[model samples]
Target: MTSLMALVVGVLYAAAIYMMLRRSIVKLVIGLVLLSNAANLLIFTAAGLRRDAPPLVPDDAQVPAGLVADPLAQALILTAIVIGFGVLAFAVVLIRRAYEVVEADDMHQMRDTDT
Candidate 1:
């Protein structure tokens, strides 16, 4: 499972980079989304995939009695997801406005309008 996740992360990273390098603004946004997902997955994978009990302590005990899934990674991923969504939304809006004003989705074409 870890190996599979690692492979997936690697593929996502590669695809994201490829898309980000394209001249199209839409592809760049897609790449940014992919990159954010890849980062989240990387954090999740690094935290391990053990399907143990939840990280909760018994009412009578001060700590959990057995191994438990790490909550830090989950929390971090959740936070990242929210942040990624916001960032993606902003990027899309910005791109849409730029496209409307510049009449071009390609960066090179848009740059030519600076005159």
Candidate 2:
């Protein structure tokens, strides 16, 4: 499982980097999303893939140690995902506004002014 996760992370990183190099706003957005997923996967991988149950302790019962997944990683990943989604949304909006203001649809042209 760990190896599979590593492989997925590698592929995701590669795809994200390649897309980011392209001169299309849409592609850049996709790349950013993929990169975020890759980062989240990385965090999960680092948290140890133990088959731990939820950290909920039943009343009048004591669960043994080492039986709960690392909550910190889960929280971190969730926060990163939300932040990445917000960034992606903002980037898309910015791209659309740029296209409308400049009457341009290509990235290369956007890099230059209409002067």
Candidate 3:
């Protein structure tokens, strides 16, 4: 499962880079979204895959029994997801405004108007 996830993450990163290199502004946003997702997946994969009990302790126990999933990676991924969503929202709004002002979705066309 870890190997499969690693492969998936690699593919997502590759796709994100490809989309980001496109000339369309919309594709760039899509690529950004993809990139963020890939990062989250990478973090998850690095945390290890297991069907362990949740990281909880019994009232009498000082620590969780047996293997427990790490919470730090989950927290990090959650934070990243929220931040990524915010960034994506801002990027969408910025792209919309840019499109309205430049009247073009192509980066080349937008660049030509910089004069």
Please name the candidate that would achieve the greatest TM-score relative to the true structure. 3
Q: TM-score winner between 2 and 3, please give it.
A: 3
Better of 1 and 3 by TM-score: 3
lDDT of 3 at 51: 83
Q: Lowest summed-lDDT stretch of 10 residues in model 1?
A: 106-115
- Sort all candidates by TM-score, best to worst: 3, 1, 2
How close is every model to the real structure, measured as TM-score? 0.92, 0.87, 0.93
In order, candidate lDDTs are 0.95, 0.87, 0.95
Pairs of residues at least 3 apart in sequence or in different chains that clash in candidate 3: none
lDDT of 3 by residue, 1-115 (tens): 9999999999999999999999999999999999999999999999898888889999999999988999999999999999999999999999999999889998988766478
Error of 2 at 13 (Å): 0.6
Instruction: Tell me the tens digit of each residue's lDDT in model 2 across 1-115.
Output: 9999999999999999999999887788888889999999999998888787878777767874557888889999999999998998998898889878877756787755554
| Separate clash counts for every candidate | 0, 0, 0
Q: Score candidate 2 by TM-score against the native.
A: 0.87
Please provide, for model 1 over 1-115, each residue's C-alpha lDDT reduced to its tens digit, 9 standing for 90 to 100. 9999999999999999999999999999999999999999999999899979999999999999989999999999999999999999999999999999889898898766478
- The per-prediction CA RMSD against the true structure, in angstroms, equals 1.8, 2.4, 1.6
Residue 59, model 1: Cα distance from true site in angstroms:
2.3
